[model samples]
Target: MFAEEQNPTTAVAGRRLSDQQAVAQFRQVVSRVEPVAERFCKQETADRENFDCDIQIVVDTSMEGRNAYQTYNDAGKPVVGFTIPMIADARNPDELAFVLGHEMGHHIGQHSHKQQQQAVAGALILGALTAYGQASATAANPYRYTGNDQRDMQNSIELGAGVGQMAYSQTYELESDVIGTAITKAAGYDPVKGARFFARPEGKRTANGRLSFWGTHPPDEKRLATVLATIEGIEVSGGISRR
Candidate 1:
């Protein structure tokens, strides 16, 4: 279904923009979307003290494949970055705008912060369980703690952290789509059209075997549906309302 919808020969995906054109469009999209995103961030985080809306949007020239991300710098300032290929792969300004909005949504949603907390909690829970099981076995057999107790706990903790991070991954993606749709529309872009960027059939890994955009942001019907639903809500409300 995705392949049919994002047919390279017939759709915008068919043509690749020049490096110069790609950069130009990205900058233009940023000019329009950045302010709106910042304002939205501020509005959403008004009650929080020192919640930084000073987002830094940048491009990673050294990275390969289509990808974008939101992270915090050492000073705790939000940073949204796009790989060079990600910019070049964008079919239109709306795509760039929506992608930028989505990245901003991650920060605004405080996803990273929440994910870290979840990781720590999950790790503790699983690690404690492992330790308790080890102690019980040691008491029962008196020889079960020969060597692998620490290794077992460490492995369990790592696995728990991964599971915890994944627990709300899909929900977070949908939430970001909702926020992105609002920001894209506010920035005068067609979010539904922009979201078509995700409709293309891609693999989890790129040619070099590194994780690709689709690897992290797996394209699915649910995501597109979320965008459409958000648009519907926006139209009904005559504007976006925080959820």
Candidate 2:
């Protein structure tokens, strides 16, 4: 889904680091990027109230696949994590830096909060529409309480919630890339090079039969375009624009 300029193979392709090398590189990247990301997060969320900018970085050694994520703890602090495989799978430190920054961007964008709201709104709208249809049908035929109506309405509501959650998935990803590019650059990594980690030619799952990184962070031309555009803006304006 990328053009020649955005090809996946370059610089670090086909180069696999040893386990020791990989772990060391991951730690080095985290040391540099984590502080930068936290500072950036605070700066971006300064005007908002109760915005959690205390980002905690963690590693899930039990996870066997290549994946990273952002989640909240029991106390609502943002936690960004990278699996062991995810760290080992990185071709270079730039990839790890970019991935961490992207996860931080999710928090900066308040995506989880917005997604929950959207899902509720979508579920309510679809449930109401289904209820209206059922009522109309019952009005026409008073004998239409076959238990299928409730099941169908429930299914519609679930589908609507899923649709709502996904409606802004692409946009959210692009926004993260925009923020990630700026963060990666500020952390002394090349955002474009880091983004190339996504343009791999592989299935959605890894060899161990678990979902791969691409399964969640699907690559497309738009993602590359966004990173490039963000880099351009940073170079021209010397900072990231407010999203």
Give the CA lDDT, 0 to 100, for residue 12 in model 2.
48
Q: Which lDDT value does model 2 have at 147?
A: 85
Model 2: lowest-lDDT 10 consecutive positions: 5-14
Superpose all Cα atoms of candidate 1 onto the true structure and report the RMSD in Å to 1 decimal.
1.8
Scored against the true structure, residue 29 in model 2 reaches a CA lDDT of 92
lDDT tens digits by residue: candidate 1, 3-108: 5555667555446888888998899899999999999889888999988888999988877667899998898889999988889888788889998999899998
- The residue-by-residue lDDT of candidate 2 on 119-155, one tens digit each, is 9988999999999998999899998665898799999
Which segments of candidate 1 are over 4 A away from where they belong?
A: 1-3, 6-14, 239-243
Which prediction has the highest TM-score against the true structure? 1
Q: Give the per-residue Cα lDDT of candidate 1 at 60.
A: 85
Assess each prediction's global lDDT (C-alpha) against the native: 0.86, 0.84
